[model samples]
Target: MRVGRGAREDRADARDIEWPPSARSPGPAGRAGAARALAAAGASRHRARDFAWPGAHGAEAGVSGCGRRNILLVIFDSLGEGALASMADALPVLSGLRREALRFAAAYAPSPEGGPARASLFTGLDIPVHGVWTDGVALPERETTVAQRLAACGWRTWLVGRRHLAGVSNWTTEHARPFEYAHLDWAHGPLHRSRQNAYLAWLQDRAPAAYAEIFPTQANADDTDCPDWQRAAMSALPDALSFNRWVGARSCELLASHGRDGPFFGIAGFVIGETMGAAPRQSSPCEALQERALRQADAALGDILRQLERSGLAETTALVVTAARGSVAEADTDAPMQESAIRVPLMIRSPGLAAGTVAQAVSTIDVAATLYALSRVPPPRRLQGAPLLATGPGSVGRGWALSRLRRDHGWKTALRHGRWKLVVSHGDPDAGVQPGFSLFDLREDPEESRDLAADQAHQGMLETMIDLMIDARVAMEDRTEPRIASF
Candidate 1:
């Protein structure tokens, strides 16, 4: 790995890097709160509004959008619109954040599976090009990740939770550099507690008492045979002390302690839908509990946000909260193009961006690009996404979203171009799915209940969308080709 600014681990860990400011001042709010607190306290003389970033009055403010030095990217593992809508009553903190942030109404995941979806989010590339198709696969070394790019731009980056983008097999790869990699399997639900190794270590560092009370038993447990995939209800530990509360609390601590050398970029992933399945599935008591998991996630988010405000970094940190993908069926495996996986909630709250809603079509691929753009860091030229907050002249973005799914039952390619959507299936007739064409007018049938493939009146519309899908596929193939053939 290339040597970066601070002291770094030869093994690619940011935590191993020490900050001089943190060593000098140990603030009470967090373990290393002095670093950021020094900056915040020293910069308090400049009176600025929420959108007016200090020392960035004209061109810098216009280009970078704000003077925010820290980025907090929060991901809820498996939360869909339906689940969020059901728990609206329980998510007051998130609801308040939604009102304070810029909400994307049509943000979609690049893939349905968590690993592949995270690959897209990190690389800003689709599944076919990135070559990370599912949970155990790593993003190819040839592709540079967002973390590497941000580090090159002088950001102190740390990943505090689930890192599905890097496969265990590719840990030796040099692409994911200048960022600490910490992975955690949530303590409840269908997740194997054995996979919560990273979290246990973090708990020992941050909350020794909680770790002492909930170890060995968890270490010796056989949670691998989870049948329902839902987490067991959390124990009596207060929300701040619970095992499920670690990532959020840890992120809060980081937000308070970061930016001694420069701005920090941290991602924290939470377990939300431990067992909620895809659409047309029956809802039971267990499913309700799964929804409660979202509430817990929201509470965790609140904890982080409250800390942000308390640390006086509230106006300067760009916060984004989203998900990898959500399941619609009882099982975790599902077609990527399904609405349950595609429809996700994305909210960005930063200093310059106004609190409003964007109704245009957008993809999770846009996430990395947007973050880089907001930080005023130049992204790699080949990344395949538009900045979600692109403004001024020539700020238009990709008006379509493409996804693919190769499942045990069948495989299909889909694209949402404008108001039309096309799903081209390759097999699975036994599962009531066939190799044929299915079209939907998303404006009239957002749920895709009506298939317009056979409607001759819209034959031309169907043809154009099919061609659009084909052209998109060709573009992906061009990017992914080993021989470098034109699409």
Candidate 2:
């Protein structure tokens, strides 16, 4: 019963902490009715459509049958493509997956922040459309998620770790929309003080010694006062009790229990790489910390994949590995529109798809469309993303990848066209300044060192890119419920 040191003493203290049973059980279904009530309340204003049940669509081109396929989506927070490539040697499992899976070198997140980026990935909508433009904003309950869609289509959906679709200011519990996840191991971050955080609860039950060491005072103590990197370095928790490992174990448990029941859509989200936890060293450079977190994540991923194989669900499952945003280092930069801030590692290993690298630009939103395709469900009309599996290697993923940042000061948008990247910033309107722009030919300047916005010779290209940016924004306008017939 004693999983960690000082388990006996910690058990005495655990009695004083308030732990919710729902944290260790299946998610509540009561939200489904609440969702209907909210919809009815706003029916006159919004006119949301009813949920469309999925029918048997024809099989995808490369896939064998029309049966629904299992989906395993693993997301690492703030993991940049550059970081993954730089530390490939240290990540054996992930590197091996990269070689065996369909690697997308030019994949980009829809937003550079966790909330908006994850919203786009789940809803296949742009930041403006979904309305989760930044970290603190809540995803509107009316907006349907991929998990809800799949659940309606007879697929079991589960999520483990880091569902930041809504605000997490309250420490008692995290929020969940209608039927978003059948089972959830909710933890906004490793060090969050939520009593409903399943990761923390698991530590209390299974590894009380480690829990007592990490949180010496109260079970819900706010340990976030210390910087994440410093806390990670100073922590006494072992690799076995790390957050990512707990997420992986929960995912494997779900797989083993539900693999034979029906097709399932599961997400295992790892936050270590972003928060700089689970490192072996007490203190290290930023790069070393990130690399160590990645290695730990790799080990956890190996466990999940091996569990998939053991359950005989490997071939029937479409495995997706990606990041919610880009590198943590981007936080220190002036502008987050850089490639290192938005570009992320993306790979997919499906039953019939050939393993190869794709250089075509793709957005994280495409992952939602691809999941719908794999499940034999028609993508909703409002989805702005196209399935990547339908596109060839040379063909563009979504024609271009777009990233957006919205703050109190202004709005910053970046558009990546064939070889060019255009970044436009609209300053606060009251300041009375015109929008400024920057152009970079990624082929020539991959690091985006030189800005061509002021160059006279590249004026023509800049104008063209500006037009594309305008067109893209116009195209992304909300179309969730179009006026079928002007009444």
Candidate 3:
């Protein structure tokens, strides 16, 4: 493991890192320069106002063409598509939003783990390109996030709840990158005792009794031996004091307090279902815990949406709801390469866009591209994803998604193209284990019960999928700084 920097060294390193030109100057002059840069890229603010969906009506029709819209990206950790569908009736708010949102039927995370998956969502780059292949891996400072890009273009960026861009440990709070977020309310988890945890601080200030009962500050009162489920249950307080509710309340406050001066970008990261437990004694208890957490999270989602409507920002705000990775309940095995492990819920409710299901397969990395499209900011050349709103041929609704998992458990890669899904296990040669393959026709077996890799009849299909996977990996090779000259 790499040694973490001391507080003083961390501060110095943050100061030494070069910020973007717009970030260096915080007033109108910086904004104007960013505007000029947008103009040079043929995406001026004025042109952004005129932007409209193809075959869609103009300003009179209430399409999102008025100006740059505020963006609220809500990520529910471990909330998979299956879980959402199964709990739809219990989650009235999410169900209602789904009716009026553009839902992606086949959305996959870039990685089957939280850190790399979120890194891809933020940077629009694959896990390999970003090098955050597992949890605890720090995102390189050089990679620019969509939040930074929007902040550079004069948007007020805020982050509430968890942001696993850096490793979260019991010893220290995770550090934020410079100018990454203008305002931050960070809490790694509800039970975390990090002094920087905003949730616990809020509990202490608002509900001292509950805070004292739940979080005794004595170092000897260690509950490390207790199961995660029991700990989560103990920490799960009333609606007003719950971690998810706190995140929702803060996001609503941010939205309510904002003026009409400039567009804003906020990320509300909720961690309820994610902490149900690392391992459950029984599936029933785990399922029940997850269900309860989802219901709470649903209420939180409702709070944010109602605040948006009540504050009159609903019409001009683009709401994106997705997950970093799937839940343990959805996965059939402990392996991270399964479809259930990476397939997540993704939906976008933007101005002027019609609500419907998009059948094309897409990756969460596309969320970054979609944000840039909504804000009318020219996405950096390093972005590997295309705008989700782009229409006609060669659009982002490509019928394929890729997910990678490289961790202590194993190195696995999964590719979904058309109806076929292929998973390749690059076993450790040093361990004397040979590589393995698993193929499934999702249409025929959505549960992925039977693997067709050894079937004689499907040999041709397996070879074709192998070739497609190889081509995809080659295509996704880092082009952030493409070679201009052979010399």
Candidate 4:
């Protein structure tokens, strides 16, 4: 149960804290509603009995006069569930939380990469509703974020770390103004500037030999074997140290100062995985180095936790550890869309959450709903994800998650429903790489080595799954038609 020694102290002193932007006060009626919502969500009455852990050091329901509960969401980029299991030796902090936190065995991302997945989380809408199909796609100004909704309800909301919203360029003053304390790495530069420059420098210095060793041929010259190639590629851009440190310190400060008065919303995101095809330490073949990067990221999370506990905000804080997306797995093969790229480790610990494991197929889109449900804020009606709090392990793994790739000719869409998945290459499958359907018994064939689409018995089932997937994609396209002007 004791995950780390003196890890608590290491957290409090890690960095300086920053408070969130204060908004107009909520009227008495709104406050009452918030209270009711919180109580209904079980935030106000989290007795030791609330936890499924029998021997846990239980505490009485503690709602500080501060008004609202605090949320510290830590999302690591490209950290997959398989990677967590593979690197279990290095990631003790995360593995340890399996006992106390609710683990969703089949957590999924609606999109394949950062932009669309994060867009889904923030807007509570599917890709089509938000119109943010990929990275750099702008979020329509009219759509609301979970943070924006909470802020409007009188909660001080500050967003720290990488800002990967699809449509940030057309930001408006009223709905999409800068977060109270916005921390982002625009590209790559200085500690507070570019992430690319640091990455390039790391590549040149830390593991220059690996860089030289991997980029021997032009076909793969652009593709380096070093695991941290993204980091090295990002060296040509900006630095995110101050932003990372600032966000961490500020989260603790905000939790301590605002936790007693009312609830606050804080989001701390990190791009721990490689951004480009190269980076020095991240590119090392040594599994120890790769794991160390992940563990350091975990340690950073521990720091944030220590701050909350130090300020007596631990029990009242809702801490969610997740990822925007997962890293590539099976580097030995050509497969990139397996469980590694889409499946992530999800750990949700809140006063309102019942401690246990949830084996249902959930997506990133559900995150906003969970936050709003816990904070007493109403989720935007347009959200596509369902509320997952307090839900028991589901028997139906019937829901499918969608992923898309923007190709030169057209867009490629993928639909994964439980054990069967279908990939449709819309633009030019006739040119050679046409759309394909892959079916596997995930429980029996976790590696996806066997393709069952050719099986006669599974033909009907595959067709049914493919039809459903195509229908979902069509629905998404139709939903975004009206939001074209918002951005």
Q: After TM-score superposition, what is the CA distance of residue 481 in candidate 3 from its true location, in Å?
A: 1.1
In candidate 4, stretches whose alpha carbon ends up further than 4 angstroms from where it belongs are 1-67, 166-247, 257-259, 276-290, 330-334, 394-398, 408-410, 427-432, 471-487
* lDDT, ranked from best to worst: 3, 2, 1, 4
Q: Give one digit per residue, the lDDT tens place, for model 2 in 1-487.
A: 0011222333322221111222212124222222233223322222121123143232223223468789999998778888788888989999998899999888999887777899999888888888897766888877778888777666788999887787665353557766768898888656676778888888889887766666676633433353554465424467777778888889999999984767899999888543432221112111212555567779999999999999999989999999988874634466677887789999999999899988766789878877877777766656666677765575423356789887442478998856778898877667675678888978779989999777665654565566556656665667566456978
List where candidate 2 sits over 4 angstroms from the true fold: 1-65, 170-172, 219-224, 227-230, 233-236, 273-289, 328-330, 429-434
TM agreement with the true structure for every prediction: 0.71, 0.81, 0.81, 0.67
lDDT of each: 0.59, 0.70, 0.71, 0.54
Global lDDT of model 2: 0.70
Clashing pairs in 1: 188-231, 189-230, 189-231, 190-229, 277-328, 277-329, 278-328, 278-329, 279-328
Off by over 4 Å in 1: 1-68, 168-190, 194-196, 201-223, 227-230, 233-238, 241-244, 275-289, 332-336, 391-395, 407-409, 428-434, 477-487
lDDT of 3 at 152: 74
Please state every model's RMSD to the true fold in angstroms: 17.7, 17.4, 14.8, 16.4
